[model samples]
Target: MAKGDILKAALSNPNRGPHQTALIRSAIYKEMEQFTATRRLPPSLDASEICRILAPIDRHLTPDDYDRLHKFSDFLAVIDTSPNAHPGYHLLGEKLSADLGL
Candidate 1:
């Protein structure tokens, strides 16, 4: 499946609750780790696609999910620091912040 599709599928059940959410997050983290293994960053378009797909589930993410994303993706680190770097970054950052009250 495509990256965005994978995320969408994982997040399809919005009311699945926290345990399922955590499992989904772990799967996403593992996929991201594999995807980023040889690259320092995802292309901007790819990141945007992923962020957009993840927007709906941003509220479902645990703090540990955010931590794992930060640890794995330099792309996310850059996005977190400079949200204006791309529309995707801004959208994702805003969603995360609003969802988590961070």
Candidate 2:
């Protein structure tokens, strides 16, 4: 999916289901053991780094929603690995949260 589409969908839907929200929340809160993976200043981590399954969201999420989440995952992957995350990270995150109602 195109990056823009995913971001748009994320903005469209911020309300998330309980199960999906829980899964995301866990990712948001969980600590990683590979803190040194960055080999530099401590960096943040994403859901994919911790592990992920869209099954919880696939139940009712739209393709756009999936795309949005996928994009968010990609964003997390970057920020989690490096300190210089995309400027849109927070925007995309807000969109995803709103879209999933997180």
Candidate 3:
């Protein structure tokens, strides 16, 4: 899952109005910037920050849309931690799998 995929989902999400889309877009870019600088995903990669950013627009999103956003969160978690980018390099896969319950 490329970062663009998440952004595209937000851009085309029919359940949200322009304001909600704009806010999510902003939040995504912010997190993206953080990743570019640190190569580290946010805590848990659950998109918690995105959800927090959405708090103001929570009532505006349909339940499914909200869930979709979280699915993006879960997707991020999977993408970042899967395939063991450096398998066995440092027992990293074992540790991540245990940490993420994968």
Question: Which has the greatest TM-score?
Answer: 1
Off by over 4 Å in 2: 1-17, 31-60, 80-102
Which 10-residue span in candidate 3 carries the lowest summed lDDT? 85-94
Q: Is candidate 1 or candidate 2 better by lDDT?
A: 1
Model 1 spans > 4 angstroms off: 36-87, 91-102
Q: Which digits, one per residue and each the tens of the lDDT, describe model 3 over residues 1-102?
A: 554365545645565575765666565665455343134333443344444433334456666555555554444444555543221212333345657878
**Residue-wise lDDT of candidate 1 within 42-71, one digit each (tens)?**
344243344434423557665554443433
TM-score of each: 0.34, 0.32, 0.33
Error of 3 at 65 (Å): 0.7
Give residue 84's error in model 1 in angstroms.
Answer: 13
Best by lDDT: 3
Which prediction has more favorable lDDT, 1 or 3?
Answer: 3
